[model samples]
Target: MLTRILPPPGPARLLTVITMVMSLGQGLWMAINAVYAVTVVRLTPGELGISLGVAAAIVLLSSIPLGHLADRAGPRTVQMWSFLALGPLTAALLFVNGFWSYLIVSSVQAIAYRAGNNARKAMIAGLVPKADRVGVLAYVRAAQNVSVAIGACLAGLALAAGSVPGYRAAVLFTALTFLVTGALTAMEAPVPPVPASAGAAFAVLRDVPFLMFTALDGLLVTHALLLDVVLPLWVLQHTDAPRWMSAAILLVNTAFVVAFQVRAARGTGEPKAAAWASLQGAGCVSVACVVFALSDGASLVPACLLLVAGALVQALGEVRQAAGSWTIAFELAPDHAQGQYQGTYKMGGDIGKMFAPALFAWLVLGHGALGWIVLALAYTGLGAAMPVVVARGARMRSGVREVAAAGN
Candidate 1:
């Protein structure tokens, strides 16, 4: 049973453990950070919003450069240093008494977090064979979900206490997890640095087709905001379901992802298979939107049922989309520059995340059911377009290779 749950005693296992540890901290922080900022730290909502926006901008701008650094200076070393830095930065959050201090701490924390994540991706690509990358990552994701759930439960205890000391303890616990994960990260097998070449530092920027695909994938990834940002508010404001149902919806999604992400990732090692999975995932999410729309005017029982059904569909979509996206991100990039390429790829998701909450709030809270219909249409369009984008990217790469061969 343990073997099935964990990778054998190797770099894969080490990475999985690192993910679990890191996710535990993330779960704790995510659950209480907003409340802490508002009530404990005494920052207004606008200040909190500004701080998050700044952090997002930092992530978008810093990811590629940090990834490039990983490619040049070995992924393991870069990742270890990033994690070490993150421990201190996250610990600084306890000292954030005002808007400026919070902004500075959060932005720096975001940079360290982004750098470590990009290096981890590069390390995975180096350690795991292409055929097994997605499969291994799937297991890691499941482990992450499980760890995060446990961390959230721990956070719940702190929330129940509702004391400043309790909140501080949660932050301190999260900081300790980062420090432990950093120590664990140092144990992974080292991946040698990719030698840098003149004029090739930003080659991923020239890959227009890949950029387009990334953009589309980013848009589709907004399905996350639907679940995290929009759904709870929708249930509370527009539907007849009890307030507790919001938490139940998230529990349902978490259970499904933990149970089936690896199963959904199967057969998606190649680009074509991955593309199909993306489309399927998108369709499911779109259908979920329609179901959610139906819940708007439903009675209590039917509304709860519809929300649960929507969460299940959304979870399936989330798993399949994640599997496909990981495979495509790994398979499409040149192995020599996986760090930079992955960083560039990550920027797309950052953009989506930066805009999604506001966009979703307007659509769901402002416009209600019609907003869901528009979201459904948008998701379907993006998913349907992925196959063409992937094909175009492949063709462009093939052409570039042929040209280089002729020139040689």
Candidate 2:
């Protein structure tokens, strides 16, 4: 079990270590970001949200191009440069005082981070064979989840002081971690050469079937918002459970991911298998939504119980969706252009993140329990549609291959 959960000794293992450290830094920063912005940066919640939204937009726009660069120059080269750029860029966050500065710094960091991410994904794809890629990815993600939990706990210690000094300390620690991660990534062996045909930029955008699959995957990925934004708000505003239950919910999700992500990733090497996993994940999300809704009017004991149940179900969905999504992104991508395809695939989640806050607020918060029902139905419909989309993409790719074969 331990050997299965841990990445085998090689580039995958090294990359997992880098991922763990980087995620730790991210966890630390994220835990105190809002508070730091309010007390130190003196930005209102609206300003902070707008700034982050703009930063996310920057990342979304740049991901494909950066990924193309990775494919052209090799993921190793791109990753090294991104890490070198990130160290200083992350440190710049300390100087952000207002909206424009925050936007500029955050946008730069976002671009660097996304570029690094694309390179990392490409690197992993290159390092591991197709049969092991999803499991390796799962291991990396589980390591990240564990590291983030530890970082969050450490950040909590700093937050206890509630001072600018404490926040700065955490930020500096995060910046240091970026430097370390970059150095570690630079030690990776050179990437193998890809096919000449994979060199085209923006070619992925022309694949209609793949694009449709990405859109549907994006909708399913909105389960992230359920944990990050919707669940906390629901518990605070609608349920009688204690506030600490919110944190507990996150812990539950993390534990679940660490324990079962690899299991969820099994048999997802094929698109059909992946699609089935996604559908099951969607069903879990729907159930979780119902469970969360039931917590609304329950007494404290029952409310907490329901919240825990919902969170556990949601965690299961998250693991399955992530595993399936990784498989789909990797398997559907052209071998020679893994970076670009993965970049395109990642955009779906970014797009979802961009709109989810407002959309969920309107649905789950605005309309009350009925809104949860709407969300569950949406998950069900989207989940049900994934297998069909996967099938279509499979057929389309098969046709392309046959045409190429005939031409040859």
Candidate 3:
């Protein structure tokens, strides 16, 4: 079943390792952020909020340029430079003691992080065949989450034994992981070349399918943000639920995906895949949102059940989206300009990350009950729209077909 579409497990196995290590590094890196929050910055909720906002801003700012760089130099080169610099650069995180200095460190880290990420994903697009992208990428996601679990566990053990410096050692481990992964990435054979000029980044978005996918992705991200960002606040402010509810909900979600992602990823190709995923994801998430929105008078059991149900549905949508979007993006990309087009697509995602938080929270705060209704509507809308978009994409001409038919 798996081999029909995906590359053999042997080659994809390496990408899984790379993805797994990055996930571990990310989990440990969280400790670095926490340490910064407690010891040096001493930020209150309001000030810390601003610091995070700055971090998001830094990431959004870097994605486009770094993405373009991946297109130009190849993802491998970008990955190597980006991660090799981060270890020592993160050490600077130790020395910085003020808001502006923190900002500088955060910005540099953001650039490195985003660059490495875009390069890796773009390289995946380069290496993996079209039909396998979703199933294969699911393995990447599963690996990442599993790695997160391990990293978090190790960090806890270290802190239990040694406290603050133990956490710093965890950060060093993160730095080392990046260096090793980057070096490994460099050793791989050259990827397909990408064309880059400053203008090419913006130019690729003019395509209709690309624009629609980005918009749909933005709509979906709003709810996912709730899973992490807004839900915690709600638990603290509105519900009598325990503190572990947030962590518990996340655990439930990750656990479900780990169990089922492989089964979920195999799907009807292209047109059908997109529509089916949207329906599944949308319906499930919509149910979850309503349950969550009206949910009260809860034992943790009910909350966990409803949250896991919604997350499971969301995972379904993720599989479809992964396959559908990757197929369209790769299929539609200009042959000589794969990297540039891929960068443009990823840049659109960064745009979503930048904007979705305030937009989602604004609804929750301003409209309250009505705001949740809005989020539900958003999921339903994406679900509704996907089939139509997929239908249209199916009818359009890709560059691949034109070149083949025109051979004299």
Candidate 3 lowest-lDDT run of ten: 1-10
Candidate 3's C-alpha runs over 4 A off are: 1-9, 41-48, 157-162, 195-202, 297-308, 314-323, 365-370, 390-408
Q: What is the lDDT of candidate 2?
A: 0.86
Regions more than 4 Å wrong, model 1: 1-5, 400-408
Model 3 CA lDDT for position 78: 83
**Whose lDDT is greatest here?**
1
Model 3: lDDT of residue 372: 72
CA lDDT scores, all candidates in order? 0.89, 0.86, 0.67
> For candidate 3, lDDT tens digit of each residue in 146-208?
778777777767766656576567767877888777777766656865645423565554668
Give one digit per residue, the lDDT tens place, for model 1 in 190-228: 999998762399888888888987898888888988877
- Kindly provide the TM-score of model 2 when superposed on the true structure, using C-alpha atoms: 0.95
Model 3 / residue 108 / CA error / Å = 1.6
Clashing pairs in 3: none
Model 2: per-residue Cα lDDT over 136-190, one tens digit each: 9999988989889889998999889888888888888988888888888878887
Best by TM-score: 1
| Higher-lDDT candidate of 1 and 2 | 1
